[model samples]
Every structure is written in C-alpha cells, then in structure tokens.
Target chain A: MKNQELPSLNYVFLLKQTTLEQPFISIKMMIVQQILFVIISIVAFYLFAKKASEIRRNILLGRDEDLTDQSEKRWKNMVLLAFGQKKMFKKPIPAILHLFVYVGFVLINIEVLEILIDGVFGTHRALEAPLGSFYHFLIGFFEILAVLTLIAVISFLVRRNILKVKRLSMAELDGFPKRDANTILYIEVVLMSMLLIMNASEGAIMLQEGTGNGFLISTMLAPAIVGLSPESLHLIERICWWGHILGIYAFLNYLPYSKHFHILLAFPNAYYQRLTPQAEMRNMKDIQNEVLYMMQPELAPPPPADGSQPATSAFGAKDVKDLSWKNLMDAYACTECGRCTDACPANTTGKKLSPRKIMMATRDRLEEVGTNINQNKTFVEDGKTLLHDYISVEELRACTTCQACVEACPVSISPLDIIAQLRRNLVMEESNAPQEWNLMFSNIETNMAPWKFSPDERDAWIHS
Target chain B: MLEVKSMAEFMASGESPDVLFWVGCAGSFDQRAQKITKAFVQILNKVGVSFAILGKEEMCTGDPARRAGNEFLFQMMAYNNIQVLNGYNVKKIITTCPHCFNVIKNEYPALGGNYEVIHHTVFLQQLINDGKLVLKDGGAFKGTKITYHDSCYLGRGNGVYEAPREVLQALDVELVEMKSCRSKGLCCGAGGAQMFKEEEAGTTRVNFKRTDEAIETGANIIASNCPFCTTMLVDGVKNREKEEAIKVMDIAEMVALSLKDQ
Candidate 1:
C-alpha cells in the first residue's frame, strides 16, 4: 500500500509493442470494460464541463446589460476565487472534502501525461517509467486520498440519511430528495470503488513484482501480470488503464455541467477567494466609472448636477454585472455541497431560500450569458432579455440575510449577497421591493425601527 | 460616569461608549440578561476601568427587527445606536449578544457605526491578560469534559473563537471540541431575534441541534458568552432532560463561579 494517487484527466496514449507491452487476448477485458467506459467518460467529462461552462457564462453575461469585461481585477479575482477558495472554508467539512477532490482532480495532469505517452503514443513505459519514482509515490498518495474522499462523502450520506441534518438533504423530509442525495452518494461511491478496485486489482500485480512506497501501485502489478499469458496480462493492463482514465474523464466532464461540477470549480473558486469578509463585500471599492456606468439604469455612476433626482442612483449591485467582480466570481465558485443550506436557519425551518439553489441559479444564469456571449451578443441588449427570462422575482426575496449561507460556504461564495443585491435592485431602482422592504424603508425613515411601535411606545420600558 | 439613555434619546445623542456594551432589548428587559449586564458592569468597575452604559439611554440595537425581516426598523435602530456611540466619542466597545456584537463590530461601520467593538469573551480574555481577575485553579474541573458552544456572533460573526475557551481553561474545566465547533459551530436559534420570533417551522430547534453536541460530550455544563445562548441552552437542557445535568451559563458566569467574592 502506497500513498493515494489522484484521478488525472489526461489524454492517455495506449501504445503498442513496448518491451513491456504484450498483447492480451482476454475477451472480457477487451470487449466489456473498454467500450462502456468510452461512452461514460465522454458523457461525464467533456459534455458536462463544457455545457456547464457555456450555461454559466450566458446567465451572467448574456444580456446587453452584462458586465463580463475580463478586467485585470476580475482576472486577479478569478485567480483569487478560482484558486484560493477563501469562501469555501466558511463551512468546514464539505470544504475539506471538496478541497481534496479539487487537488486530486487538478493533479490529474500527472497521469494524463503518463497515459498520453504510454497508452496512446505506444510507449509502454513512456509515461510511468520516466516519473517512475515520483509516479509510484503519487499514485500511492492519491489512492489513499481517493479512499479518504470516499469515506468523507460516505459520512455526508449518513448525515443526510440517518442523522437527517436539514438543508443537507434535498428531500421534503419525505425521504425522496434524500433518496436522490443517497443516489448521488452511491454514484460517487461506485465510481471511486471502480477506480480503487482497478488500482488494487492491478496492485496485486505490482505487489508480487515488488515495488515499494510509491503512488502508482499499478507498477507493482506489472509482475503479477507475469503469471498470466502475455496476451491476458496485456488485456488486464489495458482494461485497468482505461478504467482509471475513463472514470476520471467522466468525472471531469460531468463536473462543470452537473450539480457535481462544483468538483471542478470548487478549488479555483476557493483559491481565488475574496480577501475581505462576506459582511464587507460591498465595501470593496468600485473601479469602473465610465459614463457606461451611468448609461445603464442600475450601475449609473452617481447622479449629475444638482442631484435633484427624478430617481436616485442606486448603491450596491443590481445584477451579476452590478456585483463586484469578486461577487460574480463567487457565483461561479459554488460547490453545491449544500453546506450553506444545511446551516441555513431559513432552509431548516422550511423557508424557500436554499443557498445551494442560489449558486445553481447564478451558475445557470452564467451559462445563459456565456451562450449569448459565444454568439457575440451584447450583454446590455441580451442581458435585458435573459434576466427576467430566467430568474424570478420571488426567488430573490426569500433570503433572510442571516449570513448562514455566507458562513457555510466552503468556498465562501455569498449567495446571500447575490440575493441581497437582487433585492436592492428590485427595491431601490425598480421600486418593486417586497411589501416588507418597502415598509421597512419608510419605517426606518419615520419611526427609526421596524416595529412600527409608536414613538410614544418607544419609552414603554422607562418612566423618563 | 455611565450615561443612561432611552432608546429614543440614544437615537439622537450620536455618542459612543469607550467600550460600548451594546445592550439589546433583552439585556434591558430580560431579568437574566439584566443580571448578566450588571455583573458585566461590576466586573469592569472592580477592575477600575472607566465605562458607561447605554443605560436607560439605549434602545434595542435593531437586531430583533432586522432578523425578523424588518430591515427598515433595524436600520433606524442601528442608526440611532450608532449615533449614541459616536456622541460619546467611543472607539472600543463590547457586547454580550452575538447579535449585538455582530451588528456593532461587523455590520455597524457600513451604516456609519464604526468602532473597535469586541465580544465580551475577547474582552474578558484581555482582562485576564491584564491581571483583572484570578481563578482559584483548584485544578481543572475533573469528570467534566465540557464543550463550549461558539455563539454565532462571537465565533462565526467576528471570529473571536479562542478567547472563551481560554477563559474556560483558566477556570480549569476540561474542554472537548464539539462535533460542530468553531467555524462549523451549530447555531442555537437565539440569534437574529429567533429567540423572540417563532422558530421557523422545523423538525427540531436550533438550540437542541447544538445542545445535543454538548450533551454528547457527557459534560455537565455548556458555557457561552451571549445571554440568548444561555437562555436557549438552558431550554435545551430542560427539554432533553440531558442525563449529565448539563447547565448553560455565560463564560462570565463560569468565571463568577470560580470567584471568591463579587
């Protein structure tokens, strides 16, 4: 048993006829494993990650009202968000799990190089032999991590299942959405099981051959393959190699497009996370003051002249564009682990706000925006059509601003801020706040409190 | 030299307490919290620290209204509270409610209520550092593997996480980390006026979710800084009839327990 090696999404080359590359004639390895894997890998990795990327870009930038200008600060923010994951640690466990998965996924490059050179390029020892010592160590390490990740994810299932931590489970407490959570957990468990099983099955080969303390345990399996006919050994090697590669590929591709895409986005989001606190996200100074800022009704730089305004220039964000660059980055960083929902008092108490959903909405919207952008649509024009087109007014109002969502996010994405900004737009700019917000504003202005307690009643506590 | 102001007058004064103990409505009206405030005041007085109370001059810090979705009222209260803190020329302040602590330290600056606000636990830790009080140190309380609940305001809200535990250890209580402690500390549902309003329709209460963690410790007591936490944890104990005879108290109360005199 060596250290755990992570699943790397590299184009592995299955080369023919290295001194070590013996052809296998095993029918099971050739016919059954390889074909199903190709399809699964294709669907999971390429289709999902690409589709998710497209959808999120469009949702955030599809409109003429869009603001995905790729500024230096935004790029810096992306580095911070996509890399630092500052927001993710706000929640503890899920952050840790997601963090490992992310590192494991990124380091997949090591293996990808191996597969491309060895599997595809016809260099049997091309990849692994070169990084042999390092490779052996790395695979051993990721294998352990994969095992640990599987354990952690399993605990999440138990919490969602037996302990029944609310908001963590998507069920109506009816045991259905929970069933879905379990199913997802099962998928993860099965995938990892397949991955590790292939490694261990191969490891018997390596162990008999006798390699020690490296990541790629499969190297040891090379000797175990010695017992089998050359053809059989070759077939098993190919089967296991494809199993590992295709599993990783499917996971990567599935990541961006599916709920699980948080797997891919979580790390970068965490790494490039905001340096300031969630409570102070609005305090990050604004940069762009082009009249373009004013042209749009929402991001309008301060009003002109006497300030005897027909309508006041709004403070805070109006849409994803109106949000600070980091804020937009936060939307993209969500891992959808439901940590925020689990911590949310509102969600636990049966309120409409699901922090996970908020992230999903943002990602979905970003996708909408991305599609429009790829088509060369102006955010200003397309944004108008895309917004009320995708998201609803009711969805934005459900937030309590408890900062639970803010606090629970492992990557530290503030779905709450997004929700608040949405509320700000509806209230300040559009004059269409929920009745409570409208009353709240007036109440603060006149009575200085929301109780609507009469000014006389203010002193009900004292005889003064 | 405590300047007392009603919620009404406090709204207008625009003063700041040197260390504004931003008392919420419960601190003023709830007997248990009022006692905590008085003890808090007495502790400062014994330490020969100059201080002022928002006194009768203070009003609800708008936490209740704000948490209840009455943002309008919350702002007014916050503005009024900020005005009083400013009037006093106060910079460093403190509070017992995680809610009040959060509002002043984390949130107030956004609405013009800037000050160096700290939670009481952190402040108490400072006092200990300054040699303000002495613990009997009869040795750590044996057979009590106590776990402290990181009140949302003090822990998650402001990140003053280690101070309370230091105060606990100073009193010599064995501390065990809860399953949901520190960054992942479970909420007790006493924040944001959840103490006042209805518990937003759930299978269980937040306090119970958190308290169960404490109970699982097989510890007899749970310690915290905020009064709302005290109230909720006490309720949690009563409800579960936790076999360990677990009781909830403010960290100040814990220190008071170790004190020879008032």
Candidate 2:
C-alpha cells in the first residue's frame, strides 16, 4: 500500500482489489450501495429537518410579540448561556465533565464532515491526498477527542444507570426519559469505540508499511492486533467505518424527539432569553395599554387598526398559543438536566411544583398540538390545554416566583415565566385563584391594598 | 418627623418637597412595618431633607394584586396611584418597602407613572455619602454583631444587595455574612404575594430556611431592608425561641437608632 500511489480516485480500485478473491462486489453492487447510502442520508436529513420545522411552527402558534429588541444583549446571552455554559459551573465537577462531552462532541463533528464526504464520494481518507502532514495531526486530535468523549460518556452512563445520581433518578426522569438518556450515552460510547477500532484496524493493516503512529489510541492498539491477517484487519475496519457513519445519521434523526433537541435549540433559545432583570415580570401589554387609557385618557395611544373585528380575550395565557414564542422555544430547548428543579425552593422543599416538569409539560403539550395539526391539517380541538390538563393549578400556585429556576437554568430557560403565565390563566381566565388570593385581590380593588384597611387609615401609621 | 405632611399639603402650601415618600400598605398599616416607616422618616428629618408622604392619597402600588395574577385589580389600583403621583408633579420618590420600591421604580413606568424611585437603603446611603445624616461617634450599633438578610425584592428582585449593607456599614457594626447572601440569597418567602397566602405544603417554609441560614451566622441582629423580610425573620427568630438572643431590625431602624440626635 505504501508503494502504491494513494490518489483519491484510487479507492475504487484499491478496495475492489482487496476483496477480489472471494465474492467481490460488482460495479453494479457498488453503485447500488452508493445509491442506497444517498437515499438513506437524504431521507434522514429531510425527516430531521421536517420535525425541526414542526417544532418551530408549534412555537409560533404563540401570540406574536416583538422580542427582537437589543440584538447585542441577546447575542451576549447566547454566548454566555449556551457556549460558555456559565450556569453549568454551579456544580463544578459535573460541569467540568459535561464540558468534556460538549467540547469533544462539538469539536469531533468537524471530522464528520470528511467522513460524510467519504461516504458520498466512495473515497478513503480523501483529505490526506490534499494536505499530507496536517491530515495526520487532524486525525490525531480527533482521536484524542474521541477518547475523552468516550470516557465522559461512560462516566455519564455510570452516573445515570449504575451510580444512580439522585438528580438523574428523580421521579420525572422515569420511562422514556430514563431510557432516552441511557440510549444517547450508549450510542456515544459505541460510536466512539467504533472510531477507535476502525483506526486501529486500519493502522494494523498498514503496519507492513511501517506507518501506524498517527492516531494515539489506534497506534497503541495496532500492536495488539498485529497478528491478525491483513484481510481480516481490512474487513474489521470496513465494518467499523460503516457502523460509525450510520450510527451518526441515526443519532441525528433521533435528536429531534429527545430532550437532546437542546443541542440544536440552545443557541437560539439563549439568544431569545429575557434580557430585562430577572426580577422584572413582563407586564401584560393589553392591560398596560388599558391602564394608560384609564390614567391618561388624552395621552393614550389608539389601539392598532387592522380593519378586522377585534377579538375579545380574557387577560393572560390560557392555552399554549397564549405563551410567547420564546417561552415555547424554551420548552423545546430544555436539556432536562433537573438542575432547575434541584435549585427550586418549591421542588426541594417537597412542594408539588417542579420547574423541570413545567418545561416538559409545555413541550409535551406543544408536541401534542403539533401532531394534531399534522394529522388533521389543522389544529382540531383536543379539549386539552397546557394549563389545567398538563400542568395543574396546584403546581402553578406553589411557585414563589423566586427566580431560582431562572437563575439555575444552564441555558437561561426561565420556567418561572411559564409558571407565571399559567397562574395568570388560573386567576384571570378561570377565576381559580386560592381564596386568600381572592381576598387580597378584593382588598386591592376596594381599599387599594392587600389588607382591609381604608385609604384614610393608611395615614394613621405616619402619626403613630 | 412628627408632622409629616401629605403631598397634597405641600402642593397647597406652594412648597414641593424634594421627594415623595411612598409609604406602602405595610408601612402604613402593619404595626412592625410602621416602625420602619417612622425610623426612615426620622432619619430624613435628622438629615434635614424635606420630604412629604403620599398620606391618604397613597394607595398600594398593586404589587400583590399583580403577583397574585389579578391584572384588572392591579391595573385599577396602579392607575389611581399613578394619577396621584403624576398630579403632584413628583420627579423623585422613595419608599421603605422593597415591593413598593420595585413596583414604583420598575413596574409603574409602563403604566405611565415614571419617577426616580429609590429604595430607602439606597437613599440613606446617598444621604450619608452627601455629608448629610452623619453617624454619632462609632454610632449606636457599634460593636454589635449584625447579619444582613437579603430580601428577595431588595436583593435579587432589584440587584440591591450593596445599598443596605452600605447603610449598615456606617453604623460601625461587625457585619457577618450568611452563607447564601447577595445574588445567591434565598427568598424570605414573602415575595409575589406569598406573604398574603398560606405557603403550599412543603418540607419547610422558605422563611424558616432563610432565617436558619441567617442565625447560622451567629450574629445577634438580623438586619434587613424589606419590611416583609423583617417580619419573616422576626417570626423565624420567635419560632426558634431565640427572640431574646436574636433581634430583627430593618436597615432604616438600624440607621435611625445610630443617628446623631439634634
């Protein structure tokens, strides 16, 4: 192989010659394989993108409001929340490990571009022909990353399945969540192992040429497989190579259905995050306008005119569509790390509220609605909503609006906002507030205070 | 301090005070919060800063109604208060309660009530910095061990952990910090109208956990900026039967106690 020139196009001849003796695949078979690969890849990509757009459309089912102000702040938040993973550092150990997986997986994907090219073009290490020396270093770096990713993935598996970390084993993580997490970890481990084994087997076959030192892990393992015949080495390398690329395609399609959708949505989610101070709740703009009209009639701006009958609505959110698109995006972007619930006072103190569940319920309801649209070609009445059907009034009321979940979210997703919106539905739309809240509400209406004191008595404390 | 005039009184006299004191519902009706109001008023008087209260014209800032999800009631109360404040041509205002300060400073502007609203801690800190309101010698709080509890509204709600501490620093007290202070501070379980309702079933009340964090600092006094926090911490101290050992006081009360008597 060292004596032979390794041009990019030579792969067809080289691979065929290696398998010439016993049941060599014909040109027709090779063409069939190439066509099948392209079809599978195209189908995978099309389905993945279709599902992603479904989620986007579902999010836009929300009422329109401009969150486009302060582009600079949004960009900074994206960098800090998603890329920098600032909030993840609260738990230093897990964060460091997660960083390994995050950085490794992200950086390692650069090599996948080449693998994808190789699969499409029927070429073997085509980049090596273009850039000779750096290609070795590139593969070497990718190999090292693969090893780190492997270690991290194994640690995650142990933490979830064996060590049983409490946060991962929480009640909400049962069923598909538990399996989904483990499945991704398993996929990662297998993909990483196949990469190393493919490299090692290729290096073993190339040992006759005295060149097997490029990949760190593979170079070390090549000696262990030195006794194996070159044909067997080639066979093993081909299987590993095919398995790795196919697994990656499968993973890509799987991501949209999993909480791993955060992998793609995190950037956009962080960019659309609420930039105002965490303590500042967004005022219901309709009510704000109404207040302005009541307080300063002459200065009140006219309501927007679309020349259509204005729809009368009870104030605040009642359905998923009443939520802002950014909030819906937050639901889709949740990584389901349980960090928010861990930090939430309500959840930690054994209240019925779980911030993670709030996000999950939102995503679930959105997904259900999306499926309805897809099936019926329009949203049919499911007679279910995100508020009372998925998330309960008790859960909504239990939140203290402490902003702890907002602060603790690694990706800057604010479940507190979602809770507030749901609570708004309960009080404004359904009149389902606790009796105490109703009392306080009446007091404010009658006396301009949460207490039952008269306005004249407000001055009594001044004299006291 | 004894003759606190209303904004209406000042207007009728052709005298506009520098700032309108928005005595919130608690400061006007809750007995414990009234002490905070008086202490803050006394400090203003000692500094010779002419300020007037909203008095009978002052309504609740509608913070509780808004938080409790009653938008209509909140808007009704908010519009009425905004009308009164804007009518007075009030350019600057201050309040002792964090809920009032937060609502007036942050929430009110959207409803056409914009003013330079400062919380009393920040106002007091400014007063001291401006060479008004000097401390007497080492001041009354000298040699006293004080731990400051960060109110959700005053601390995390408004990013004002420093102003209260700065006001307390002037008293020359030994300031011991709780484990979770500043941005990481726990709520006193009183924000978002949680004060008006029974807490949802839980293993522990938020105030109990927060007060326990404060007491763990082993300070004799738990100083706070918000009246709600003061009440919650006071109750926490009582619950632990350490009322004799631990005293809960507002930042204004601490400053007023240490003021130089005229």
Predicted structure with the largest lDDT when compared to the true one: 2
* Candidate 2, A391-439: lDDT as tens digits: 9887887877778778778887989888887777788888898889988
lDDT of 2 by residue, B1-262 (tens): 4658888889899999998888898999999999998988888877878999888888888888778787777778878888888888999999888888888888888778899989999999998898888889878889899999877777776788887788888889999999877867777888778899998998988788887888898899999888888888888888888998899999899888888866
What would the TM-score be for candidate 1 when compared with the true structure? 0.65
lDDT of 1 by residue, B159-234 (tens): 7679889888777778888887876677777654455445544466667777788888877778878888888888
Model 2 docking category: medium
CAPRI grade, predicted model 1: incorrect
Model 1 global lDDT (CA atoms, 0 to 1): 0.59
Instruction: Give DockQ per model, in order.
Output: 0.14, 0.67
State residue A208's C-alpha deviation in candidate 2, in Å. 3.5
In candidate 2, which residue ranges exceed 4 Å CA deviation?
A: A1-33, A291-309, B1-3
lDDT of model number 2: 0.84
